[model samples]
Target: MKVFICERKMEVNYNIAEVYINKILFSHFWFHLLSLGLRMILSCLSSFRTLVNKSNPIASRNQSC
Candidate 1:
């Protein structure tokens, strides 16, 4: 009876550990994905700004030239 009780306690501990590890892994995955998305957004915005700046002078100078 004692051995059975001990085994049960160990099983419960193992399950709890597994759940905690999975939660940590899931959080890390989401964090990496969020970081990647932010980088992509920033890259796109920078490109758009460059394009706007490049065209602004051309459009303005055409009237005088």
Candidate 2:
């Protein structure tokens, strides 16, 4: 009957929506993780640069008697 067909169509639409939402969530999770990793790497690089600069200036300074 028409009612049974309509019910089937709604079920199919619900399943399709669920799949789409899941894919969006999965991609969001990866994007978040990637950004966090990049932030950590950038912080590490900046700290190393500071350490190198500090050491370089101290090593080159002339000692006063």
Candidate 3:
């Protein structure tokens, strides 16, 4: 009877460990995805800024003129 109880406890511990590992993995994946999305947004904004600056002559011309 004692051995059976020990076995059950071990199984429960294993299951809990598995759940914890999965949660950690999922959180890491989500963080990486969020970082990648932020980088893409920043890159697009930078490109848009460059495009706007290039098209605006006043940006390049001397302000005194």
Model 3 lDDT tens row, 1-65: 99999999999999999999999999999999999999999999999999988877775576647
lDDT of each: 0.98, 0.94, 0.94
| lDDT for model 3 | 0.94
- Top candidate, metric TM-score: 2
Model 2, clash count? 0
Model 2, span 1-65: residue lDDT tens: 99999999999999999999999999999999999999999999999999999887777774431
Worst 10 residues of 1 by lDDT: 56-65
Count: clashes, candidate 3? 0
Q: Candidate 1 — which residues are off by over 4 angstroms?
A: none
The alpha-carbon deviation from the true structure for residue 12 of candidate 3, after best TM-score superposition, in angstroms, is 0.7
Query: Tens digits of per-residue lDDT for model 1 on 1-65?
Result: 99999999999999999999999999999999999999999999999999999999998999779
TM-score of 3: 0.73
- Misplaced by over 4 Å in model 2 are 62-65
Instruction: Give the clash count for each candidate.
Output: 0, 0, 0
User: What TM-score do all the candidates reach, one by one?
Assistant: 0.81, 0.83, 0.73
Name every residue pair that clashes in candidate 1: none
For candidate 2, give the lDDT: 0.94
Best by lDDT: 1
